[model samples]
Target: MPLYQNREFTTLMTLKNSRLRIFLASCILLLGACASNDELDSQANAAEQQIYSEAQKYLRSKNYDMAIKALQQLESRYPFGKYAEQAQLEIIYAHYGAYEPEAAIEAANRFIRLHPQHPSIDYAFYMKGLAAYSGNSNIFSRFLPTSESSRDTKHIEEAFTEFAQLLARFPESEYGADARARMVHLRNLLARHEIDVANYYFRRGAYLAAVNRGRYVIENYQGSTAMADALAVMAHGYLLLDMPELAQTSIDTLKVNYPDHPSLSDSGEFDVAQVDEADQSWINKVSLGLFDPPQPPQFNYEP
Candidate 1:
């Protein structure tokens, strides 16, 4: 009884030990597999970072097209990597630098929609406005004395609205100051454009239309440099339209606001045409400097 029982117990203990060894080996193999996968992931991350760095170099060198390609590759290859979101942001910058304004605007809008809470979202907004602003610039106006503001007020108004949104939403953004400055210039441009339209009406003998344009300048652009000219236009236009009291009121206001204006006569009456004619001499006419040029039918307002 004692011999059989001892042999059976020894066999059972040996089998249990054999099973434990197999279990430990399986655990070790599983851990090794996990470690290999982790290492591969790390290597992949480093490669992604290197690609992102190369893209940054392209951006620094102002090779926007190359940068865009590299960034696109990095994003596609490592969509969930550490640099994926950053690559997206840099793509927008690259589009902007490449003078692809529509693309830049589209990218910026995509970023804003996808990453609304991103810390650098204000930059996207700023870029959007800047792209719109540059897109509206006329090359001819850069050299000509034409007013940019008066040319195409539509794009200018859209850009101003974008900037306004940026300023309103991110008052403390790095771009806020610049946006504000642009907004001021836009306001003046719009005002001057309106006044130019008023002058056109005056020259065409549309007195009431001219007066309405001047009133638009006064109401919509209160602090513009064109206010003095607007008052002159209103006074002259009212007088032409047989509105004596309104003309007198505009004349009085113009005198109070701009006593030394060139459009005013010695008696403080609105007399722009007289002043214009007086300044136009033979030499001045030939030289084209005798007086300010008349407002063209299609004038631009340069900011």
Candidate 2:
């Protein structure tokens, strides 16, 4: 135990103590960093929850525009948050509530693509179909004397297809029953639209075109109410085309199915005399029914 040996031992002890202090300080700094991260995460989650709550409140209040804004903010801020998917789903409803059908459809489509396995996927599809169905109507049509069956049926057909897909994929969905009911209405509308087109062609002396349209309705929309009108069109067109046997077949079928159809006489026969009398004069045909007008044949039942 000399003085130099004692001093060396003391220096070694001091160095060891300094190194231990540095190690402990590093550990403390790391722990503080982790705690800060946890706090920040908690704050972020709280903010996300707050935004989601506000969105829900807006939705419950039927303030769709504000709900959409809040939902969009939540999604943009925390795309991977717990409420992100729910926010996306609610955005579709918000747009629909705002009467923005195309936007709702697009949002629903986006949700379907992004979260294909989401539990609410069926809801997305249902909303998409509903949006398309709503898109077929407008404020004007509600007030004005408009014939929806006479307008372009592209949107209506799209809605029908959308609902069909929903039923095919999610047969037990809660929305299935309503979707089915809407589909029946849409199918009838489509059939009537085809019959209206046939009637148009028949009025313009396009008997062959009218017959083709009627045949299309019969082949595609068999169980529809338009079947009787389709048969009448086919019968009248066949008579005009000099196919007496085909005309007779259609007339007989119409007689059995729709005996009280307008084109039928009191004796339960197709009124050939009325159809023959409906032929337009040359002047009327040239004028497109504008001048020298003649009563055109109407194969559709008015009742």
Candidate 3:
């Protein structure tokens, strides 16, 4: 079911009759040429096929270390031989199967970069993206500090970007179906990450921070419910900072973007619900639209 194998199977099954005959003739010619070649060269070519077979057997047994070693040996022994491409693909599997996602990503990326024009480039890109994406712990953990299990999302984004490239550059590739699915998941994760950071700054009462985060969500996330919340939060943060012009801009967003959003009565914007009644009365004086829009109270910080 992997993109590489699918391509091989299709190549074998769907060859036109003329093409199949041509392929058979080519194989006969190669065999005749090999018979006439130096005996040592023929033996070495047969040994190369055996090495490939042994590597595939190890892969089938899930003996990833042995498989990796076998493939690496194959590369060292016959760098430009017929098995090099297959060796590259198996190396990715060997690393991935051994829970070495970062290593798998690097290997997959190298294959794609080195063989950009190869027919299997789509599979290489897709596998690279999968390697990086699989390294991430999850989408929700963005609010927390980086941890041992955390992978830099920069890697994940690169994977997604590669997968998208695979989709675009190889429109007829077998990689497209699953790569498209992964692309959707990655896009949603990026959007969710934006919302999580926005909510973090919003809850900390850092209006400027909240506004920047909120704007990121809106500009990036587009038509989701999260976009509506982001717009509302931007407005609320502006209001709390006593920026009426910016707050007015958010007012239209609140009304037109999400008319059905419930209005919580604690609209004074800055943690008014958590403040004492006397403190509430003071904040109401500066809160825009909620106040009469007259000259705000002038007060000095008293010692």
Candidate 4:
């Protein structure tokens, strides 16, 4: 329309065109960088394949050391490629299958640290626990410590800890089911140990001490087969301390809870009337002022 309006319109069009050109140039530069990265990736993939192939052959031949070296080389060459993850798992297996327990665990741990979000992270944890399990030896019993060679149970516990962590963190993992089955056995052993300590205190003359120890078994190991015996021992201990109320309470619990409960009497199982008859004899012979059994014999052998 007007000359000034035309100039302004031309200026706006030019600015728009410049902005569009700048955006197009940035896109071209981005594409060029992507192409360069792809080319490098292609070269890396080829080298990774070579290293992986060699490592796999070594591993298959049971040459763990050589396999480890080749896998390590692959890691150094292409640290972030698909082959890198495969190499990492192979390294763990190499150390594990070769009986290098500590190295296997370390390799598995390293894989986890580096690839925390990996879909196969559960496998890494399971492998670490397996390494721990392989290291554990149950050769020595707690008794005969001097003669028996003691096997370190640390690895067993560590294995269990790692397995439990896997189950807890990745419950849906395939390994979680097996982890639970092993835990059942470990927990039972611990429960039995507590019962043994309780029985030890009960055999001594420490009634209060026995009561406390028995309580541990009852509270902590409710379903253990030893629980009924523990409750019975606790009741006996309470009776010794002249606390008939607690004793009766414990007895009631024992009878209600344990269908096959132990005998309440410590000496032996007998009828209530027989128990009273035995008590009567005990009172007659021991307590003199109130009532005493008559002296039976006084014979003179003098001429």
Candidate 5:
């Protein structure tokens, strides 16, 4: 072979080898990049799963604040994962367990808005109602002479509405029976509240207002225990307003339904003063000097 040809052949081989090395290096770098991404994804998934598990553990131990934090982290980190919605629901439960009613309501509302078709939506509604119900009560209800029916019922009304929605939408829900029971209690409470307000009006020389409130109770809550007292208030209010016909009608209804009611006399005429003195009895006035005399449970007309 000629020397120049031999040298040219060696040069060609060297160039081919150099190109092969560069191609192999490029392939290795590309493979390394893919592997790195997979590793990062696996790490992210692990972190999310770990956080969710931690939240569950916190919940089981009743550490609601910790559970809320862990759940929030999981949701923020894995917003599109299968566990994201579940975590959001858990946050609501955690808020409820922690006695954070407003936060629980907000979270429940958010869940309902975001996943209207979710299967566990009933749970959200139940929790929302439960939160409202709890929020309506205070420590004073148990200790004071104050009547619950006479207090503000805004939260109770809100709760009743929520429970009603739940029952209407999901008749066979697991929470249906409990919600129904609460509704019954709430209805009674509202009826009694109307009676309380009517009694107040009757005491303040507002006969017409008292009659309206009493009539409302009769029309809206005919079966309630407060109906007897409501009828008495109506009869007395009508008598004071010089409406004998309406007063006679109320007296007749009261006699038929509540023959033993204290507001009535043997003659069946409205005896307003006797009922008033009984309401101011000394037994209810002895509050042991701790608070104002316990207001009598029943109100008596002063007309």
Candidate 6:
């Protein structure tokens, strides 16, 4: 070989060796950086798991406030961690256990919105309905024997709708049977609420309004336990409105379906003459129920 060619070949070999060394060094640095990242991720996951375990302990002890706080911290600190979604779901149960129904419902809703395809999404829906159902009772009602059917129907209706949605979307869910049972109770409560309003209107001589409420119950709540009372209210309202045919129809239906109802006489006649006497005299109104006190008429049905 010629001398100049030999020197050129030696220079080319040196340049290629330097380039390969730099490439190997770059790959080593990248692998080290990747290892460091993996270590940090493992540490973060361990911390998240620790917080979640603590939260679970709190929940098992029924210390719902602490459980909620710890769960919130875990969710916020490790938003993408493996435990984050589980923390969000348990937050709902913590709130529910604390008897904070509105908070539970809100948390459940947030979980549903954030993790629509989560495997436990049915649990969120079930909890939402259960929270609403529990919210129907106030602090006073918790201690007292107040009737839930007489209270505002807002929470009751909301719970019913939520349970219905759960049934529609997760028909085979483990919570389906419980949700269905609660729905049946809610349906009866709603029907009884309509009957209560009808009785109220009837007592105040708003016969047409009473009739409308009774008709609403009959149309929408046919199979409920309140059906007997609804029929009685309808019969009384029709009688007051001077619609004998309608009254007779209502009475006949009551006789066939609810023969043992209190509103029915032993001879199968409609026995609600006292309801007609519910109108208050002007003196009774002026006396604030002191003199000639008006008796509030009631649907005579076994509660």
Q: Each model's TM-score?
A: 0.73, 0.76, 0.58, 0.49, 0.73, 0.74
Candidate 3 lDDT for residue 287: 16
lDDT per residue as tens, model 4, 168-285:
8999987787667555544443444444554456557677887886688688766654566566667777877899899878777866775444343454331222322321221111
lDDT of 3 at 84: 81
Positional deviation of 79 in candidate 4, in angstroms?
Answer: 2.4
lDDT of 4: 0.66
In candidate 2, what are the lDDT values of residues 173-289, reduced to their tens digit? 877887787777677778777777776887898999988988998999888767777788899999989999999999999899888777789998788555423221100111122
What is the lDDT for 144 in model 4?
27
Global lDDT for candidate 3? 0.65
Clashing residue pairs found in predicted model 2: none
- Summarize candidate 6's per-residue lDDT along 54-99 as a digit string, tens digits: 9978987989899999999998898987777888888888888788
Better of 2 and 6 by lDDT: 6
Clashing pairs in 1: 147-300, 147-301, 147-302, 148-300, 148-301, 148-302, 149-301, 149-302, 150-301, 151-300
Worst 10 residues of 4 by lDDT: 284-293
Rank by lDDT (best first):
6, 2, 5, 1, 4, 3
lDDT pick, better of 5 and 6 = 6
Q: Model 5: per-residue lDDT, tens digit, 174-196? A: 77887787777777778777777
Top-lDDT candidate index: 6
Tell me the deviation in Å of residue 12 in model 2. Answer: 2.4
Candidate 4 ranges with C-alpha deviation above 4 Å: 1-47, 57-66, 138-153, 192-218, 221-303
Candidate lDDT scores, in order, read 0.75, 0.79, 0.65, 0.66, 0.77, 0.80
Over 63-167, each residue of candidate 3 has an lDDT whose tens digit, in order, gives 989999999999999998888877887688788766677888788778877887876666667677666665664434433443311234575587678788878
